[model samples]
Target: MKQRIITAVVALLFFIPLVAIGGMPLQLLAAAMAGVGVYELFNMKGLEIKSLEGVLAILASVLLVLPKATWFNFLPDTVTNITLFYLIVMFILMVPVFSKNSYTFDDAAFPVLVSLYVGFGFQNFILARESGVTVLMFALLVVWSTDIGAYFCGMKFGKNKLAPHISPNKTIEGALGGVICAVVVALVYLLVWPMANYNLLIMLPLTAIFSVVGQMGDLVQSAYKRHYGVKDSGNILPGHGGILDRFDSLLFVFPLMHLVGIF
Candidate 1:
């Protein structure tokens, strides 16, 4: 518990500043995080990060993590980020053919899937930040509140399991508590940092929905970790596991926020 708290403080100290000063630094940070997330996902499948597929996955993720504005100056208008991403995917698929089936198509699929998952997720994060710091922080608050609320709520009032197979510790009661907590925090957040677009009524239900989506994202990560037979994604953060472990909820929330016109 002590280690967890210490790591959280240390991480936030380093992370918050970059987030506040959103620009190339934040973009770089996002790209690096996306790369690490790709590494962790690849690690789960016993794939080598130094391998060709791993390198390509990391590259794809970093490309996706950066905002389209960054690409505008260098990349020709003719070729989009999607085009480049597809090219990388084709290269990954071709690896098996050149290697005479040693690195099977099955092996190639994992990197591509992980790249898209981690990549687009982080890309949305950049998009959120680009929209406004308040927008990004709002998403963060929802994810963090949900996680904290679920932990304590489950310990105190949990009776029914939410998903016994994926995450045995979670409970339906806890999930509800998390949504409640998220809505409350989001309300307070709006009170302090009022956005022109969002009002109390609009935010109330949206917060609950985001909380649920965030929990589902966490469950998805838990499902994969269970399949990989690992306790945590990685030991990058002593108590927090890995970048993917910590950012799972945020990844889901940011994209959903954009989809729902929060951005």
Candidate 2:
């Protein structure tokens, strides 16, 4: 518990400032985080990070994470980020042929899918920050409130399992508690810094929906970790696991926010 708190403080100290700055620095941080997340996913499958597939996956994710302004300056406008990403995907798929089937198509599938998942997630993260610090912080607050609410509520009032197989510790009651907490926190945040375009009645329900989506994201991560037979994603953060572990909910929430026209 002490270690967890310490790590959280240290991380927030480093992360909050970058998030506040919100430019190339934040974009670079997001890209680097996406790369680390790709590394963790590769490690879960027992793939070497130095391997061809791993490098390609990391590169693809970084490319996705970076904004157009940064990359377009160097590359021709004809070659969009999506084009580069698809090219990388093709290269990853072709690795099995050169390796004489030592690296199977099945092996290639993991990195390809992982790159898309982690890549798009972090890409939207940068998009959220670019929208405004308030917008990004609103999303972060919802995710964090849900997590904290679920943990305490599960310990105090939990009687039914939410998904016993994927995450035994989570409870249905706790999930509801999390949604409620998220709505409340979101309400408070908006009241203090209300957006001109936001409708309070509509936003409140949206907050609850986002909270549920964020929990689903956490469950997805838990399911993958269970399949990999690991306790945490990685030990990058002594008590918080890896970048993926900490940002799983945010990853889901941020992208969904964009899709829903929040950003």
Candidate 3:
């Protein structure tokens, strides 16, 4: 816990300035995030997509994010474009070979999932930058509130399990508190940041909805770790485990916020 706090401080140390500056710095940040996400993803599935296939997937993910960096007028809306990309990738996965006994179909799912997940999630960071740094700040706040609220509320009042199969520790009381914290954070930020032209009602409930989804995101990662019988995604970010470990919730939030046009 202490290590996570220190790591977050270090992250803010670098993250705040890059995001504030926008342009290449933010774009570089997005690229690095995309790289880490792709690495973790391909590793997670245990599907060995290597050589040309791996490079192609990584290249596609970067290209998927580049449009978000530039203020390109022709770039499609972030949410629909990303979600659609996921569908396109899924379709790519369905392509069959001359024989079902062949290894081709077995390998198809990895690159597709990596391309879509890393591509979509990382690109949305650019959308976050569109609304200024405060938008990113609020996204962080919503996720943080959910984490903290769930911890305290679960300790104090939890009885029912949220999903015993996926995340045994998560509880219904914790989920409720997490949502409430998300809504309160949205409301408070709206009151404080008069310059941010966000729709408070939309932002508030969306925070709650995304917070729940974020919890699911965390559970998804936890499931991955459990599946692999490993601890942490990687040690890339000390004290925080890995890039995915820290920003697992952000994956869900960035795309969801884009869907609601919050950024």
Candidate 4:
């Protein structure tokens, strides 16, 4: 618990600044996160990171997440997107044909999937950040509130397991508590940051939906870890495990917000 608190505080201190700065800083942050997250995911599959495939996978993942970044300002958006997509596709397709021993179809597929997962996830995150810092911050706060609320609520009042196979720790009562807590946080944010211009009626349902999605994201990651027979994604964040462990909910929440036209 102590380690978890310290890790969260340190993460907030570092992340808040990048989020506040926005633009390239946030893009770079997302890129770095995608890189590390892809590495950790590949590691789970027992893949070697020093290999050519690993390097390209990480780079492709980072590039996919850097759509809003200024690094490619010289190129047109369409061109940049196409070039990156071509590069990633070529690498994935060619590797299996050229390097049959070291890289197989399974190996090739992992990078592509990882790229799409982390890339698309962080791309939506960057989109949210580009929309406005306030919108991004609200999305983040609601996810955190749901997590906190569920943890305490589960510990205190949980009686039935929500999903015994996927996530034994979660409870139906805890899920309800998380939704309630997220709604309260959204309401508070609306009051304080009225400039967000959230319709109270719309915001309430949005908050509840996001909270549920966030929890689903958590459960999905948990299932992944369980399938691989691993405890945490990585030891990068000490108590938090890895970038994936910390940002799973954030990844899912932002995309959902985009779909709902909130971002």
Q: Give the lowest summed-lDDT range of ten residues in model 1.
A: 67-76
TM-score of each: 0.96, 0.97, 0.82, 0.93
lDDT tens digits by residue: candidate 4, 21-114: 9988888889999999889888988888877878888888787888723677777666675478558768777886787656678667878888
Best by lDDT: 2
Residue-level lDDT of model 1, residues 1-263, one tens digit each, is 99999999999999999889998999999989999999999888787999999999999888788766675557677876677788899999999999999999888989999999999998899888888999899999999999999999999999999999899999999999999999999999999988677788888888999999999999999999999999888889999899999999988888898998888
Model 3, 146-237: lDDT tens digits are: 99899899989999998887678889999899889778877888788743445666567677888998888898888888887767877888
Write model 2 residue lDDT over 187-263, tens digit each, in one string: 99999977555788988999999999999999999999999999989899999999999988988888899998888
Q: What is the lDDT of residue 176 in candidate 3?
A: 92
RMSD of each: 1.3, 1.2, 4.2, 1.9
Where in model 4 is the C-alpha error above 4 Å?
80-83, 195-198
| Candidates sorted on TM-score, descending | 2, 1, 4, 3
Model 3 off-target regions past 4 Å? Answer: 47-50, 68-102, 194-198
Alpha-carbon runs more than 4 Å astray in model 2? none
Residue 233 C-alpha lDDT in model 4: 90
